[model samples]
Target: MYALLPVSPLYAGLALVPLALLLFTLVVLRWRAHEAASVGMFAAAAVALAAYGLSPEALSVASGKGVWDAVFVLYVIVPALVFYHVIERADGFEALRTRITAFTENELFLVLAFGWVFVSFMQSISGFGTPIVVVAPLLLALGVKPVYSVAIPLVGHAWANTFGTLGVAWLALVQVVEMQSVAATALALGVLLWIPNLVGGLSIAWLYGRWEAVRYAFPMVAVVSLIHGGGQLAAVTVIPPEFANFFAASVGLLALAPLAAWSRYATPTDAIERRPVMAESIAATDADGSSPTAVADGGTATAADAADPADDGLMSLPMAALPFVALAAAAFVTAVVTPLSDALGSIQVGLSFPEIATSFGVVTEATAPYSPFSPLTHPGTFLLLSALVAFVVYRRKGHYEAATARADEPREAFSRTVLATAIPASIAVVSFLVMAKVMDHSGQVLVLAESAANVATPATYGFFSPLIGSLGAFMTSSNTASNILFGGLQQQTAAQLGGLSEPLILAGQSAGGAIGNAISPGNVILGTTAAGIVGREGDVLRVTIPWVALVGALVGLVIVALNAAGLLGVA
Candidate 1:
């Protein structure tokens, strides 16, 4: 019966309705963001319930999955944002902003150069939306228009989306393909990224400010790309893939000398120039329930600085800087320091779904690893640690004062964090769960995969794989999910058609998922929101889609060339 079945085309088209509704409701109808999200959420849930034929048992299973998804988001995303928020509340972002602007005032240099380097750094440390979240505001503060601020990061950082932050995309790819992961193939993929990453860097720079600044900083751009791209590739092949981003960032940090040497053509440094001033008043409360009142700015105060007397109680720049620097260092150490990580591994939180899942023949009771021995180990833990450290640093420095208008309490911090991030995250989780359930119940992913496979010729698999990958990202709005859905299908088709090694074909799948993230509607929405250009998502898409297509095509061509050259041997 299964073999005789005609695949349902409706399932594929049906999957798009929610996204379309999002466009219509959010863009055309001009609904509030939350309202649009709510409508999409319910629509997806209805589809899932209807398509899946959810009985009590099935509903139970779906609920379990949804809860887990929410937990994952809460555990990882919420803390990261909270950490950022606490620092912001403490006036650390302002300090960091001054330091960056002081270093480079040219908008293009800040956007292109800083965007590439900083995005790469963040991706290596924390891959999921980290680049967009961190860089968008930084760009905004540097005087780039809010819209371009988000768009630039999305475009330039797209190439590294696969092997980034210790190869999350590759890890997911392994699950889908069910093959022994190849470090060499993963490394090769990262090496190949240099071409597109460089191109993306240049394109983003030119788009940000034309030839004025990027033209002058060409050598620095080249060196940064080479160091970052090369170091990432080397780490994956030589060390563990988990260490890829950490090592790359570490090495790239050291390459500042080479980058500096390459910029010898410039008469004087073209970086930002800021005046020195006294540190601002910092009034942030610590995790330990104490508020201090001495915050220092990263730069000196100047006559040109805005004088907002009402905000003088904010924390100093150095206090704010602690969290970011600490977070990066902790994440790096946690991934690399096996002894410390293993020790922290002792504090795991095992989640059990006993009777509820078994009644439905679904697996539950997955372990949520939480080892404080590796206190700074997980990305979430690192972010939390950074927040804690920021509190301490600021308090000790007298940047925070206990009796100065408010008490330093963890309750207030929790409330603000939940209000800002948790609400949005809940909406996102519900939407994704319903969509996944709908696709699974309707057998949509399988039908779509088969149809996609039948459409391509052997020579065109390279090109088509990326398109399929893009479709998956578009549908799911996640590179990880896209790989999970299509990686095996692409590998199987490659094997059947041309006998290509499964790893290489699977690698192609992973690569495509990475590129597709740039234009994915969900990513665009989140990025635009973070960049403060909410309703203008279509504008960002119009600019990003072409670049995404071009990069995917380039990756596809390389895959084809590799296959033809016998570089990826037929099994």
Candidate 2:
């Protein structure tokens, strides 16, 4: 093996330039995601070539890998948008929205339901930003402002990033890092992630109406957090990690009924109804006799013209929920059924890349199959199946056929919506992923991690460990990728630090990566695209960043305290 390049302050600082520039462009300049990601991609390429001595061929391989990865993400995006449009054309959302309002008109409780509980449920089953893409618009349909609509789910589902999606992120961490105690790591992560789970629920309330909303929603948030976080912890100890999040989130979803039945939340409170985060009431109509719905650019759309229920007949709530039910069933079978999951996962697709090395000797090993994708088990497959099921069922029910002359044909509308939303989103995802690959291949990510590790003492290393993982997630916009990039580093650093519990530190790393999804540019773009607020990514970030930081810092302190108290190790 060639000796790796020595880390230095100058090299580390140079390594950080792309990410710094990305943040500046995104948050300060308020550039659209595609624009900002493209700029960052070029910056990373420059830094990789000039400072890290990355070979052009290696760069090509990395970029190609990034493109391939983007395809995986796009698979979900395209089908999800198709599924969304299919539902929209069937007037399923209005039916669902009506059902939700009928269940409880308390705005705070409504926000928590779609934003926290339902989004968490989505993440548990299909979490490649699926929760945000699916739930944000539902919130908007309930008359929430577009920005908060996107932001709410962004924060709400972040805590599930590590263990959700059938524990893909957790499995990735295990694959990359050799751990002394897998069970301990799982338990620690279960405990640590609870903070964000709790914080995310409360944050949604706070975002809706500030302190008053929090006070109003506190009991419900507590109950949901217990089911979501505590239930996950309890489940993980006895059940397999893959089933933990799904069970917990499913229970949370079930609990919502009773929670909504509680006297306080069952009736509309005038105080809670006056939501600061929602747009004008859904009943508000423009002079043209159309109901105004908030659009992403702070504009209103005449959605009511199409969405208003007519005498012909609206889809029943069960029919409206059919697609998601199908989606959940498909995901459950593929993820939880052992024989079916194995058989479906047997046919995998991946590309092989030759071992590549930078001039400085950082090496990426050659593999027969890199990042293999099992198409049948993928979230995209589930989404597409759901879309197809929705079309057939809705058509049979005469929902789509009943559309007015003004409405486009269902198939044509679905195709148009998918193309419009997926194309720009694909570009942004590719740009962001390629930038992440370049940074990783160039040893820039390593330098950043090592620089942080080197700067911290054992006393302070716990605090910095999760931050490194957060940095990785911010760059990659994936907890799985973040763990793959930094799991070993976190493990090695913990060993080197001495007295730090490896499991605790790794748990912190996982927890930090989980929460970081809230502010990841790729994730933000997914939310914005789904909510029809594509360019206002900066606004969503502005809302989510503080929550992420707050949750991340709390995770760090928990790590520190656990380490100090000698509770980090497995008994």
Candidate 3:
């Protein structure tokens, strides 16, 4: 394909038209993701037809393959969403919030709890802006300024995008690039992703209380970040990327308790306090998973907290966390347990695409087995299973009766989730997939990438790599989309550079897309809407853009350094 495409100025620039349209609609026009992707998809199809001599049949087959590929991600979205709302209705999030108060009374640490750990944990399981939707409100409710509320979680969850959402973005990158050395790319991504992990934690702390609080929390942050970040890199060496975030977060979650205890005695004097504003009737929970109370008895809150299951007494922290626990366990067992995974893997379902060739002789190959959907091994299966478990637990604990007092409430919630998320999610997923396919099949990707390789020296390309990744993410508001659109380009550019390692360069691309999650306009708008601070999107953007740029620059620099060092088997 690369050899077939003449990397001419006109062809390269023309090939970029679709991508430019997508980015403009998303960032400048602030069009909905579905709408922008629609424009991009059409633009790509038109360009392929007029510029690349693509045939209609080839385009149809390529688009069909995209639709099939989209199934893998969309399935994850619907089930994860249903599970999240089910847990929310169960007061599970509140219970998790209450549980954090047990760790420390430091308001800064509380910010860290919600912003760093909680959001990261949520991102690990649920993608599609769930972390910001779920966590920002909690932060706002805790008296953080609206901007800080959105900014904190926005920055906090960026690091989790690749391995998080059960490797939705990571899978997109690896599969699309179709690297000869999958493990090498995975490993590089693991280590490279840690840069954002550490940045996210510090950004949250700094946003909460500036340098003073960051200084106080520095020790805790470093220790936990090392534990989680280092653990993730190590996990990828053994386990797949899907399980890396889970393994890393679990290690951090356990290590945090000891860190909390250590903070008690090693407390700094004149620590910056994060004072809370008045909340509604719902009391802020204290440590030990107790709901807020009017009075404190011997450092223990004494009250029938409204957040607890009033009709069935307070739900245990473990019970409150049952869905997540079940999900983690299910993923682990299915992934590691051979018989179960094999049984599930065998039940494959997908569209089998026949090989098709464009008029320009660009051939999109056939897949004999096609895009397979493993019924049991798929993350969506676990999500659905987890949602079911959460429903049963929430019901048995009288959560339904206490809150809704209706038999069909659960059904309504599930239906509402499907109604709200299904269409938009489908539109966004399909549009990007179509655009990716059209561009690839018509040799547009090859032309653009080869042109880039011709234009930039290896060092300049290394520095610009993250910016390219960021541009894709900013346009689509998805790390997954960025990888789908540009991962192949990154891989091709690395090969064309003559001495660069594909994995090493790809790490920067992946990391940049992850970091860009914080400043993507769609994400900013989502955060403001979810946090109940509409029309104040500018404020949120103002606070986040600088941090995102700084982190993105550092990522580029790191990539350049690694490329020059010839580390990780750089050619």
Candidate 4:
């Protein structure tokens, strides 16, 4: 048995008080995550200082660690988002949307194909709110109801979140559990989360339409759910955990082929009229041969009735999609073409700063700073390329005059990308950092994890572990942070419960973190903002809370069944 950290019972009790306050502040007082997090962190820090004694040096160490955590998010999300915005500003996204919609007008197919498959792909590539920001606007453009647009994507691809983007959250989980491979961990979690994920998908589909939509898509949804959930489990168990989301999303997309065929032949009971792409004003103006809708919107003409081909020009779908094609190709080369990816990744910057000797203990320092113009393997690099390509395409094919006029204007292009990508991305990053730092430094997180874990009997921690995992994610607003904060605690509790396998325990931790995204304050805010439903966070929460609880409960049951069946590999 490992030696446990020693502390007075009173101090331990006091250590947990911050957690109680965190719950009250978030659940009762209804504070934003940032507010609750700060309170929790300050309280935890104070308790640690009082019980463990103050350490001036620990401050530097903690701060350094916090910065490192922030950098990790910046490296991946910032570039990815910038990349997306660049393409968006170039108007390439519209072409891609047109091509996708041309395939089928079935709303159910569109939601599943784009909302689930495409969004999952985005999540696998760039996961910080990229899915909703990118997909929601596209859905809105596709004439999907704004409310359904906001909610469907938010819930549909959630399960893949933990292992997306090189399995950042899963990596964090394993790091906390001190496990090397996340295969077993992901498998265990995947098996447990399968039902909840299925239910979530069905629920989202239902919200998209109604009982008819659910009935129509049940078979297809099942196929998607199995492919997604099963593929994810298999990837973690057999393939690299880092590739789990990428692989699962790819497989799920493939499963859609048969489903699409089936839908085409299944009978035309609900063949709703094809939703028009443009709004009434734009469509009416285009039909009247007035200023081309694009020209009117682009400010190329002052007269409302002037028909200007130069500003109103629209490109063939392929022309606009060049940038995305390039992006996908580049991303694939970087991720799958081993030599290219390695060569680019090899040009990294790594440095170790002198450890600060302080009252807290010696803390190691490390940083990997890169030039702003990193290679295409960087998500930012691909995004930038896509943007530039998209801009060129937009100019050459659509608005020749406008293109020539803006050819030399780089700042305008930059502004376009920044407005679309940075606003939401920055907010998400700030929100995540604030929540993580507070949760980590505060004793509230530990107390909360312990409190949740304590709800189950020692023997039942496996069955109940996901709830504790949910609590950690809720507090931290990040699966990665939750894993960092509670992975060890969950594993230790499971160990004491009955030598439960580390993989199963860690899987529960990752699974809980994934589901928590639905209830996560940062995500809720982003979803609401994307849907232009700002200030309705409370309403969104009211809808999401029950789903979160249900998912957690279902996961708990799976954990229990697996453990009882001796299939969980409990030690």
Candidate maximizing TM-score:
2
Predicted structure with the largest lDDT when compared to the true one = 2
Clashes of each: 31, 0, 3, 5
Q: Comparing candidate 1 with candidate 4, which one achieves the higher lDDT?
A: 4
Residue-by-residue lDDT tens digits, candidate 1, 1-571: 1252234566455555665786577657765445566666566556545553334565555555545544544455556556655655555655565654444333444455556777767777675565676676565555454556667788767766776766667778766665644754675467556656777777775664456545655776787677767777777777767667656665765665344434353123344232111121122223443222222211112111224234355554555456767877886676567798778766655344333222213222333331112223456677678778877777676654532344344435546644554466446545654455444433445556667677777776766777778767765666787888787778778767874645556666777777777876556655654554545565666667778788878877887777666674544
Kindly list the per-residue Cα lDDT of model 3 for residues 534-556, writing each as its tens digit. 44554666677788888888887
Q: Which is better, 1 or 3, measured by TM-score?
A: 1
**Looking at candidate 4, what is the lDDT of residue 65?**
50
Provide the overall lDDT of each model, using Cα atoms, as 2-decimal numbers.
Answer: 0.59, 0.83, 0.71, 0.60
Per-model TM against the reference: 0.76, 0.93, 0.74, 0.73
Q: Is candidate 3 or candidate 4 better by lDDT?
A: 3
- Sequence-dependent TM-score of model 2: 0.93
For residues 45-120, what per-residue lDDT tens digits would candidate 4 score against the true structure?
Answer: 5665565343545544444454444454455445445554545455444445555545555556766676677777
| C-alpha RMSD values across all candidates | 8.5, 3.1, 7.3, 7.4
Report the C-alpha displacement of residue 265, candidate 1, in angstroms: 9.2
- Who is ahead in TM-score, 1 or 4? 1
Clashing pairs in 3: 101-287, 102-287, 102-288
Better of 2 and 4 by TM-score: 2
- The regions of model 3 sitting more than 4 angstroms off are 105-107, 118-191, 209-213, 230-248, 264-314, 405-414, 465-496, 499-503, 506-549, 565-570
Off by over 4 Å in 2: 1-3, 281-312, 405-414
Where is model 1 more than 4 Å wrong at Cα?
1-6, 23-33, 46-60, 175-184, 210-217, 234-237, 256-320, 343-377, 400-422, 471-481, 499-501, 519-543
